[model samples]
Target: MTSQGLSPSDIASVVDALRELRVRSLQSRRRINNPPRLPSRKALGAVVEELAAALFPHRLGADELDDEGIDFFVGYTLDKCFRVLEQQVRRELQFSAEQAGSPVDGIDERAENIVRAFVSRLPDIRVLLDSDIVAAYEGDPAALSVDEVLVCYPGISATLYHRIAHQLHRLGAPLTARVIAEIAHSNTGIDIHPGAQIGPSFFIDHGTGVVIGETAVIGQRVRLYQAVTLGAKRFPADENGVLIKGNARHPIVEDDVVIYAGATILGRITIGAGSTIGGNVWLTRSVPANSHVSQAQTRSEIFDGGAGI
Candidate 1:
């Protein structure tokens, strides 16, 4: 204790404080008994990185592999990811069943089935991500090539994570999906909910401060810039004033629409196909197809310095 420069009393005090906090947490309903464990964020993040490597074996993968060995590398990576994801999925199912106080029978079989279905869709996910890469390359004049887009664009990284997380969310493993999404959000500063439905050829340029809410539906070839938020205008409350859980709240963005930076489109309103939403626009209502929406005109007047200074 002398060598460590901490007396026994210091350790005792810290332990006592932590115990008090633990007791208080239980009283506040924030701590509960240990049952089946939940999904691990660290393991989920590793699986996501492996999936990304497998999806783009040539671009986002290891540098040591040549073209001839790419197929083998991808296969090996996919197999490894499948095994890890299956375990996590099983944990998630068991935890959920325990929370519901339901029987955990057949959870293993269900988890295996979900993982198999998710793995089978990897090729489709790759195809969708290819379209996203192409969209990013073509939409941004500064982008040099598709390879550059894949390697350098934060938007692409965020979208790839969203695609994987969205698949997990659809398969009823939402906790794991959210963990994966948060990893990408932490890395890219772009927050996309795992439940958001995004279509092919989606391009988000300079993607900092971008937020896409849960239940937001976006269509093909849609382009959005930084600070764009597709959010809920209001929450529907019940008789007791408790906010409703699951309802259509975010905006429905149609195909070929472009939302500029700093724009916020709220509620369940639709942004029609081929429409353009200007920067910093605050929109609440639905616009017709092919429309261009922007803020109202502002008039500036000259002011004399002596007026109020």
Candidate 2:
């Protein structure tokens, strides 16, 4: 206030305006009391990183540790991650219950059970991640090694977050899942919804501007390049002009399909198995299996030097 040369009355006026705005916001939006606070994004991000480290201990975790020490470190990291995640899951469930006006009795046991099931799925997630790393290394000519893909690729990072977040979304913690996915989105420009069902060995090259919608289904060994979108073509509206929810809107990309950069495949159409979509192609309809789609050929013309401008 001193630096800006604002008087006491000016400050009071601004505060009063802000208070009125806050009141208006409360009246317009849903209201709650004593709502359980979800875990911070930073904390959830740390949990994901710790889990990644535990999964690839020697590569991403403490490389200095010996065989026995590596096992111990992994165990410790897993336990710590699980404990923190359980607490967050509990808070999420409690918040949901409060929002629904449901009783929260025995929510602790339910959260613990959910977390235990989630923890048990870590090995399977690791196996899937291994396939993803291999796919990235194999698909990219510039990739030197699997370790390089795991450690350096933005696509791998986003996929890692998606895999973890997808599990959480399936287990009834979509808000937490979305937070985890957004962490990856902020770090890398890839925006993949946690509700998207993606198969193993999915690889994205130069991942900036890639968007996968919530209803998108991707099969195994699918590779996509930069600026590729699997999006909804249109939103169905009701009589009141409100957009309908839960429709199958995004594309289904089948196995072994390679979609090149700047391709937009929209709506519920299926890109059939073993198809190749060329760069900058705008596609909407479903294609047969093994189809090859590319932009229409363009003709170039040469102008004479004496041509009028």
Give the number of the best model, judged by lDDT: 1
Residue 170, model 2: Cα distance from true site in angstroms: 1.0
Q: Write the per-residue lDDT of candidate 2 for residues 188-269, one digit (tens) a residue.
A: 9999999999999999998999999999999999999999999998899999999998789999999999999999888999
Residue 140 lDDT (model 1): 95
TM-score of each: 0.90, 0.87
User: Which stretches of candidate 2 lie above 4 Å from their native place?
Assistant: 1-24, 27-32, 297-309
Return the top candidate by TM-score. 1
What does candidate 1's lDDT look like per residue over 1-309, in tens digits? 447777899999999999888787766754456634778989998998899999987777899889899999999998899889999999989888877889999999988898999999998999999999999999999999999999899999999999999999999889889989999999999999999999999999999999999999999999999999999999999999999987999999999999999998889999999999989888877888999887651101112333210
List of clashing residue pairs for candidate 1: none
RMSD to the true structure for each prediction, in A, is 5.3, 6.1
Evaluate candidate 2 by giving its C-alpha RMSD to the native, one decimal.
6.1
